[model samples]
Target: MNTTQELTLFDNESEVELFKHKITLEKIKNELINFGLTSNQSKVFIYLGKYGSKTASEIAKALQLPRTETYHLVNSLQNMGLVTAELSHPTKYTSLEMKKAIATLVKQEQQRIEYLAGKEESLSQMWNELPFFVVETDESKSEKMQLLHGLAAITNKIKEMVGSSTENIRVFGSMADVLRLYHSDVFDWIDNAPTELKMVISPMTKKPEFVSDLDQDKIRSLVSGSDKKCFVINDSKEILIFMRNANHPTRQTFAWWSDSETLVEMMSMLFDLSWEKGEMV
Candidate 1:
């Protein structure tokens, strides 16, 4: 009707019809499995779906497939119950009734879903049965000790060792060593601490007003923290020890996430006893 506009279909009903035609073609091209129906059979189904029933010769001419190939595809589709012969003068091939075809497809989908659910359950059981594993290292003590360093490095060690952990952790820091650097990133971490945090501040923090809310409220104070030779030990298997004081930013530290129950217990006992004598605020 709009022939005066050069017949470009993009902004009109012609474009909408074109897209709908493409979507229907894609849906009908069911290459469901290999070693199965040939392309001609698929096209015959689509042809029947679009143009209705047609004789073998008529289909061959419409699809441009060899007469012999069309015969083979029609025979295959007939066996699969997807195409049926209509008893007429020349005989016509028709795609199976749509309702029956859709029922078969739904059954196939249900079987596939059940198979996947069983597979996932089996995998979950296997994963749950796997034992915890540890990778071994032969690094020298000096090399291992040199790994921890700086504010970022040290705080990460604390988070890993104490975050969400139910056990008490030892954070031994020199009060003077952390005065200015206290609120930097370290206190931020302490504010959102996960588990119990037992601090061993150098006798410098005599008042509770100076520390973070988490530390001031939950912290158990005592002597012997990371300050003099700053170190944090959680249950023996995990230890974060400073190489030197905080005056210089370059002094590195060490973190040992070990599984030494004896070491953790001893350090925890010392902190517990000292905390008994310490005061909050």
Candidate 2:
């Protein structure tokens, strides 16, 4: 840890947004790459920003970039006025002036947003002629919807019906719970848990390789680590399975989760028999 670490702790939106691009397997790492900074340059800056002030050696170790290459980047950030060297003892560089760096990023983003907004506005205006109903919700209904906005209510309802399910949750459809509903931290909790996970993927999902040869791995790991540690039962009992949008709670989109024992048990039985047959690929 060093100067970069110090600044990165304050890593506001833009820095965080960098990694958001390649989160899904749908996109590759290059898709997240920015032309403004070389991968090494970005790595060094990101490391220093996240790790705080650090010696060149620390930056190299933390970023796992080669020492000689790191020195090149250190020189580059300094030349670009993005990083400053400390005068005292062990000699470290920092990138604490996030205001400028982030502002530069924001300016570019603003220009892009402006362009997109202009296009969107034009499209909306053109589509104005399309017949659409303006269903004005009564104040009472709006207030009721607001009260039920919490997904905890949805999950809580499932829990109430099934009673604390010890079995792993079987999920179908795309990663609705994660992409649409919960934060990564909460998903991590679900993923790392001993709960079983069985997914009958929807056509909307791109099935990853090795799904049915020996050990099928999907609908997990995208959130948590360690594939083998999971209990993955097909046909879950007391688990909610639905085709809901992950962002529904926020977007006010409606979704449903079934708490039926019949569905859960059937899924569980299929999972057990498949496990014996090496259906997991």
Candidate 3:
């Protein structure tokens, strides 16, 4: 057709094709980066993917990277199961099928989850052993009190208090709050521990299914009246109070825990008065 187009030499046509191939290589490299490969690693992988197989030197020269760096990238890709290397003269590396490579990554992630699940108990024990960094005035540690927030923090404090009880554990709360603890197996921990439990459920709330299963001699229900607030006194050692607005549209709850003997003694006296009015279950 056109005279200038017809006169184009072989070298010119080959250069144009090389330029288009480079553009394609850049797109493939970006996709590989998103798939979790490092930049250099992605470059090497795409090279092998598109060019079939390549020796480390060939890859280094084609990508204009140092030969030693190319070897490192290839080794990392092989370890990730994205590439495979053959033991031959000037060994060649080739990428696995994209689907198979991604499948391998997924498998590794699932294994990590299982491993963490297996170590959860030991991990929790280690976490609890770490000291809390609190800045406080000069006072006996046994007389210290800490404000707790979030459901998780409150639950942990309750478990710790219950576990440390030597004589008795007193609980006062609504049937709904009791049911939450029961479903979470807090009762199982209480039952296994060497502590007596006395619970006072609000008059507005009904008994839960696990009520009958509890120790009757230690259980009680508030007959006159009770509020939605909850508290736990672990003998004379500690007291945990949960202040809540049950009917509030926001359904907010907050808790406080203290080892202060003065504060705990006051709570214990209140618990005694409530115990006297409660109907034994």
Candidate 4:
């Protein structure tokens, strides 16, 4: 082949290799996240693993992270025994081998689970010792609505709804909303809930890993056009509708929740229609 054609061929091959490398990196990062490291922490650990020891400034520059954040990540990783720091002129950091790192994370997680399990009985006893009372009023019979601001409040409300649901629960939303719920442990709550669950997600979004763990018959993807709207209907008695802009940050997000018969009925109808239109997962 001529020089130009040969160079073009080489460029194409280089691009393909680069793409493959990126995919591999992403896979590693995801596995690291699954092992309990945050996204940035995974990235930092992978960088150190691949590039060997690096000074904090070098790591920050290489990863394009803020210097302060990089230092914090390194310190956290060191404390977790996944990264080590050397007492050199410029302190350098090194990641534990991938196998050892995984073992360390697994041990930490096991310790955490055991600690919680050990405290469960005492915690339950303490909780039971606290008396609970409910004041009955005319207001209690009336419909109620609550505006939840911020992700923490929204997550807690969803958890409460899931925990209280007894019959059926339906979730219809954009994939981003579903992912947010998963990250907030709402999925875990739902998994342990006694209620039946049905979910419909936007057609264009890729299925998430957690989808495979759920009943295939209960979850589906909308085959028609998609939108950013999201809502959850619990036992046809209440609804929570996301009101925040999809592109906005989580801190600025908010949701509307209501137990009004009219509102709940309307959202239930919408969810039913969406479920009918959804394609099996």
Candidate 5:
């Protein structure tokens, strides 16, 4: 091969080697993170392991980290037994041997797990000892409404309603609303629940595959299109209604829950009328 061809071939080979190095470094960094090092700590540990002992200044300069931050990282790594410092005028940090470092991390994690396990029984006992009380008054007998924000709060409310329902449950919504419940694992709770369940979906929605696990007799599609409003009624007593668009992102989703006798009765009646108009799935 001519000189130009040789240089071109060498360049390609160097590029391939550089790519391989990057992948390897990334894998190492991820493993270190899993082993309990922060990203910066992993970077410092890997740099020390790869290039041998380095002063904090050298490390900070090479890694483009602040000098103070580099020292903190070195100190943290030393505390974790992943890095050590040489006793010299200017201390140099060195990484523990890869095998030994990993072993140390594993041992530390096992100890932590065992410690937590030992505390579990006592923690449970202490938790159980705490009494929960609600004082009853004239105001306590009045109907209540609660505004729930975000998907997490809404999901927990659904779980509570499903778990508490012993008689019947009714759901009405668009495809997007049904999909939100399905993705949130609410259907799993419903499927396992002993309570009777009746679901009504908008006419615009095709029957989803998740309904197959449910009793088809209990599933229905509305005779006419409806808006994206979604709600659940538990035992003709409590109700949770989505206050915002069900198709909105989880953070933007909002819901209102009520145990008002009048509101529940109205919603339950509406659900029954809609149910009557729905075609069986």
Candidate 6:
């Protein structure tokens, strides 16, 4: 039998096998650390795993860790379902099957994910209310008229204007555009009504009673003599105008939005005139 000075074990087949097992344990310990286990916990788990059942004091001596710390680590691992203890006099701790132990940790992570998913909507509402987010359209920034094209951008702009409207919301639009707003839940703000909504629908379009919760008196609509889709919010603070493009074979939509007081006033006056001419629905 022969061995190199630096090599701890290598004289024969049995010693080489023992060294291989030690190497395997070290690899497993590193893997456990990567799985979010503390260094001490990974070392203790590896020791218990390799040696099968062992007393806490023995494990501490083998790992050169303090007895008290080793005991605490064992208890944590046990609570995490990675280790189990025998009820005998000097309790012996043994690592659970590696596959089952990892499965338990994965299950815990999944549960946390589901919990966060359930709270996302409420958390998003709270985040929106937080003061840290800057308001994009400040009244003082008069030149900040935002041009919005496409149905989605225009719909969102309308929702934002309606959501922040304080005194009144006057709408002039085709029945289809109004229906799109209703289905998208933009009319949800009407639940907090008393902020009067005077609407005018295109004479060629059919009217629909959109939201059931809003006070019908607060939402008065009439048939418009002319056809155009536009809305003004809070006495000319903001305005969104939709331009119909019936020429598009695909029937695509487009719109313009602005918070400029000048633009809003012009749009508001037009909406008022449309409302006056419209026959009450």
Question: Which candidate has the highest TM-score of all?
Answer: 5
What TM-score, to 2 decimals, does candidate 6 have? 0.44
* Superposed model 5: Cα runs more than 4 Å off: 1-135
Q: Write the per-residue lDDT of candidate 4 for residues 1-281, one digit (tens) a residue.
A: 33333222113344433344666777788778767789989988987897789998988776778999999999999989999988897999999999999999999999998999999999999999999886888977999999999788888898889988999878887777887877888777888999988898875457778789888999879755556788888897888998983445776889999999999998888888888878888
The better candidate by lDDT, 2 or 3, is 3
Against the true structure, whose lDDT is highest?
Answer: 5
- C-alpha lDDT of residue 60 in model 6: 75
Model 4 poorest 10 in a row by lDDT:
3-12
Cα error, candidate 3, residue 115 (Å): 7.8
Decoy 3 TM-score against native: 0.50
Q: Model 2, residue 48: displacement in angstroms? A: 43
- Per-residue lDDT of model 3, residues 1-281, tens digit only: 23332222112355344454555666666666656688888877766776678899878877678999998999999889889989888899999987887788788768887999999999999999999998775653446778876565677788887788778888877776677667757778788889888887765346566798988778777755655677888988888887652332121456778787888899888878777887876
lDDT of each: 0.60, 0.50, 0.74, 0.82, 0.84, 0.67
Which residue pairs in candidate 6 collide? none
Report the C-alpha lDDT of model 1 over 162-261, residue by residue, as the tens digit.
Answer: 5645565566666764553355555555446654556656665464456654546555555434345455666445565565556454324334444445
Would you give me the overall lDDT of model 1?
Answer: 0.60
Report, for all candidates in order, the number of backbone clashes. 14, 34, 0, 0, 0, 0
Ranking of predictions according to lDDT: 5, 4, 3, 6, 1, 2
Give the per-residue lDDT digits (tens) of candidate 5, residues 64-174: 789999999999999999999999869999999999999999999999989999999999999999996879889879889999998889989999999999987888998
> Model 3 residue 175 lDDT?
75
**Per-residue alpha-carbon lDDT of candidate 2 for residues 1-281, written as tens digits (9 for 90 to 100):** 34444333323435543334324411221222332567667667766775578998877776666889888989877876678899967779998455787576567668887999889978998899799777766743331111223455554443343234456555443334433323423334445555544444332234343343213563323332222221222224344433334534333433344435665577567545434433222
Which candidate, 1 or 4, has the higher lDDT?
4
Model 6 spans > 4 angstroms off? 1-140, 204-206, 209-224, 245-251
User: Could you arrange the candidates by TM-score from highest to lowest?
Assistant: 5, 4, 3, 6, 1, 2
